[model samples]
Target: MIVRPSLTRSIPFWILLVASLAVTVAGAAIVATTLPAMIAGLDDQTATGGLVYGGQSWITIGSGLLAAGLVGLFVLLALAAARSFLPVVKPTADAIEADDAETGDDTVLVRTDEVVPARDEVPAAR
Candidate 1:
């Protein structure tokens, strides 16, 4: 029996990998965009509490997302490296025999100095 890699085992990991990357990037972008505004608005009394609080909230959420994504990515990569996330292919005796028979021995040896005629152009023995 020829063992093929199963997609069912790998599809979820692939989805998780993509999702983790997207979440990481989105978190980084949110933090990057929110920091400058919060810093710039710190002087105004009206912007101090509400603006700073909202920005801090976003920053916290973004940091959490970034951390979660990083942890997920690390775990997935480790699992992949350890071969836990990949499908294993096992070769059976029947498969080995079939492969061998399919590739029957047809090896030929020829010296560099000897000229070998093409099969279609070979002369018949007299």
Candidate 2:
């Protein structure tokens, strides 16, 4: 059976996603409000100053785009990494009791196996 995680159970994932979005929006807002003032400060008497300021603006914009892209890439990577570490919910004895009550069978068999051995232990010879 394929089990999908519920939103209530995945609170941390949702929190991280919301926090990332909030930070991105805050960063964009700061840049939008400050960039023009920064460009104006770069102006000087020489004609080359205007060219320099324009180039600076483009460079700032390019760097911001690159940073945003990198942040997105990293966030995606973090989510992928987090997927591998999601919490596993084990069925409690209460659940088994409910199952038994419905089926009129007291016996419920559960089998579990360890996939990995302890690192300190030596492997068995074939």
Candidate 3:
């Protein structure tokens, strides 16, 4: 029952976006820093066992956080698309009048109860 506008404008949308981005960035920073260190540790001649294990642990945590952030973003996208099928709201009377003034639509409809002559009876083009 939630409308598209209300859902997007709601607090949850911003919260999700901020939280997701924060998590993703944090994850990316951790992985970016650790991956290089881990690679160096593996190549070092006397690298301690702790360095490799610690780096691997951090990398795992960072990967998990990155996945979580991506999933959150996907959920946000789905929520935004969920109500897209709903038609847009009609313009208000004031808005309609404003548009009419700006666009200058001179066409008008006339209604009559009387019957008019057939096309055959009408005069030909001059």
Top candidate (TM-score): 3
In candidate 3, how many Å is residue 3 off? Answer: 6.5
> Best lDDT goes to which candidate?
3
The positional error of residue 86 in candidate 3, measured at the CA in angstroms, is 2.7
* Alpha carbon RMSD to native, model 2: 9.7
Report lDDT (Cα) of residue 56, candidate 2: 63
Candidate 1, overall lDDT?
A: 0.68
- Candidate ranking under lDDT, highest first, comes to 3, 1, 2
**How accurate locally is residue 10 in candidate 2, as Cα lDDT from 0 to 100?**
71
* Candidates' RMSD to native: 15.0, 9.7, 13.9
Superposition TM-score, candidate 2 onto the true structure: 0.38
lDDT of 2 at 80: 64
Question: Model 2's lDDT to the true fold?
Answer: 0.56
Error of 3 at 17 (Å): 0.5
**Candidate 3 residue-wise lDDT, 16-121, digit = tens:** 9999999999999899999998888778755677878888999999999999998999988887786554444433455445546767662322222333222235
Runs off by more than 4 Å, candidate 1: 1-9, 43-46, 84-90, 93-126
The sequence of per-residue lDDT tens digits that candidate 2 reaches over residues 1-126 is 122354445777566566666656665665665555555665643445555666567556655754675586577567767665654444456665666677777554322222222134576999
Backbone clashes for every candidate come to 0, 0, 0
